[model samples]
Target: MLLISTQNITVKLKYYFNNNGQHYFQRSIPRALQRFYGDKKIVRHKLPSIHSQMLLEMNRLAHHYDQHFKALKSGQGGTPSQIQEQAVALLASHGVLPGAANTPARVPEGMYEYPHLDYIEDYLRDKKQAGTMTKVDELAQLLLSKPMPILLSQATDVYFENHEHGTSEKFKKNTLKRWKNIYDVTGGDIALADVTREMARRYIKHRLTTVKTTTVERELKTIRAVINSVIKEKSLNLSNKFERLTIPKKGKDSVARKPFSQDEYRKLIAGCVSKADEIRVLILICCLTGVRPSEAAGLRREDVYLDDEYPHFDVVEYGGRTLKTKNSVRKVPLIPAAAKVLAQYLETHTDSVVFPRYCDGNEVLGDNVSGATNRYIASLGISKTLYSARHTVKTLLDQAGTPEYLAESIGGWGKPSISRGYGDGHSLARKYAALQKALTTVLVNESE
Candidate 1:
């Protein structure tokens, strides 16, 4: 018999021979002592010989149960019932109790459990005695409510499904694609808390080798948006890990997009006259109205109001088209060239879409239209893209001395001043006049 003394309690281990000369081990506590475990004779069979390994294993098991019982006695463990059940489980696992082989271990309830929660509880109890538990409880609740080790992938899915509502299908698709690419780079299964600024910088560095800095910045922006949305919706106290990552700005070494000069614009217009009428009109609309190619291509017949006094088209968000910004939702005044193109288009057009060749069910119309436009421009010995038309419009507006506010209004660009909020904005008549003056000046210069 060996007596092991724990916290004010003694456990007796005895070795004996069974009827068939098989050795066995048994553990017991005094029946009169009801403190640690209620009076019971804990016994087990198939004992190892009294060797160093066997004695070491027995000592480890005794120390493990002793710590558990100490926690229970000191009110550090959970409820009495929980402690009792766990103690029985611990003893059974080490074969210190009879029928230990048949006992099943307890399964935790929630999907995630943390050992730090025990330490947190102990700290709370100490703080409560010191009358400083108020602020501590707040911090404790934040930890307690937070899901342990939330994955960036999981949070991103939840954010899009529940939080990101009313977004256009095109925008959603692009955003999701960017997110998937980011997940692949950043490790989808990585804990959100584990994503450091250094990791983000490394990701940007890796991407910069193959993609533009702007593209990497956009991906990081999406990551930041997803993390922010999840934190806000779930009321998580965690900070956004991607917020502080530094993104490089476009430098002198960057290949800047070349905007069309006056002569280049005229050459493009002249060259495209023999092309498809839809393509010609699409290019004209982009130049004259400054609406994005996607916005113009996704335009429906109802969006065009050529008969109105202003003769403008609505750049509204519908179908699968998405505006770049809320300010992109404005009435774009059709210049004479654009109006002439629209009239010609409406004469033979039967489809609802203004540009049927480019649109294909939730696909980004701009990408398809721009690809074709770029190819056509390349054939003309010029390197201008379809978006060069927008830069041309801006240049024309500047030359025509169009006021900043009116020019922004005409281009459906975001307002640059807080004062813009105080008024109803430039009237359609004012916008049309500004655009006419600019387009007429450019056209006359081209003709000269």
Candidate 2:
């Protein structure tokens, strides 16, 4: 015996059935919805002796249709006639229509159902066989919500604020400039999710027409970095489209910068009108210590430790200033020529900075000095820039047979190697010894 009732409502029914010597029972809807189903008799199935599973399934279908019919009656879904037509069609599709054949009617094209339990179980099993598809779909949707231009703009600002582990005004300006170029080239409004490899290749091709391979490569790397930072910060599951791009090798389409010969360097120094001039001192420091013009210009009074037995200056990031790499943060040993020039300048220098003229409130210490120095060298019939001094220093070190490690330590060239990672690299004593040997062989007349 099976007893079913719409709880405390106008509809109630008593049914009797047997399956495997046991009785079956069911209800069309829950107690909360009994008022909605009041006096509406459920359509009954008169098949062979009903089994428990079949009765349970029939109850589920009845409840599902009852809810739809309630919605239509309340004017929420459609007019009563239309709702009745849909209800009949649904019942017919499921082989539940009155006097319908045992087989289900063919569903119309372009219509589908939320999978029932049996179909749902099969779908899940197949999904397990297709790995990561669900996750990829989710990530793709998320990435589409945010455009690439917005991500690039925000990332560029953050990078400038914290470049080289600190703020660099010069680098900020340069990066912003590059970002503008990217915007101009790529039609800035394009969505990041829509950016394709073909677009990136077109941009690179455009850049190569007006710039050297190295310059194009650098710009591409900057673009890649900006996109990567955004992806990491937002935890996006997509790969960086700009990464792994093919770039020309160094010196592929451009001539390498030349180092000044000893004769040319000597003649260039002799042309400086006054030995007391800051440019003269700066040039000498670069030639001897191989420090960048910017580093020399940014030098502070406290950076110089000339009073120690082995005089050196600290090259490190301080507030607005920044080193190029971790290996660039080192104590540069002052060779004899460099120490003499610095000593002379320190005697009369009263400001906290070694070079005050170039310190224009901004931390960029070398642009003016380098410009003047380059013009001075060019006027003296030397076709070399101020950076040629650093190249000259490396050349002299190599000529003197200084070991590669010691040369790299002095010049801050190349990445830090495993062996160099051990302790504070070669001591000042050994570095100074190499410096002495290199400077002696290619000694410049300081008195000039």
* Best-matching candidate per lDDT: 1
Residues 344-427 of candidate 1 have per-residue lDDT tens digits of 877886877777888753445666787887787788888768887887888788889988887887777766445653135547
Question: In candidate 2, what residue range of length 10 has the lowest lDDT sum?
Answer: 136-145
List residue ranges in candidate 1 displaced over 4 A: 1-153, 165-168, 183-194, 232-238, 248-256, 360-364, 416-426, 441-448
Query: Per-residue error at 40 for model 1, in Å?
Result: 36
- lDDT string, candidate 2, 1-448, tens digits: 4433455744333443445554433333334333333333333333334445655655665665566555544544333333343434333222233223223334676644322222323433465677543432222223322322333445675555445632666666666666666665556644455567777777777777788888877787778777776666656666777777776564478876799987887776555424657777777777778888888888888888997778889887776776677788777888766787688877886888887887643475556887887887888788889898888888888988988887887778865455753246446767788887887745645544
Q: What is the TM-score of each candidate against the true structure?
A: 0.60, 0.60
The parts of candidate 2 lying over 4 Å away from their true place are: 1-155, 158-168, 234-239, 248-251, 360-362, 415-426, 441-448
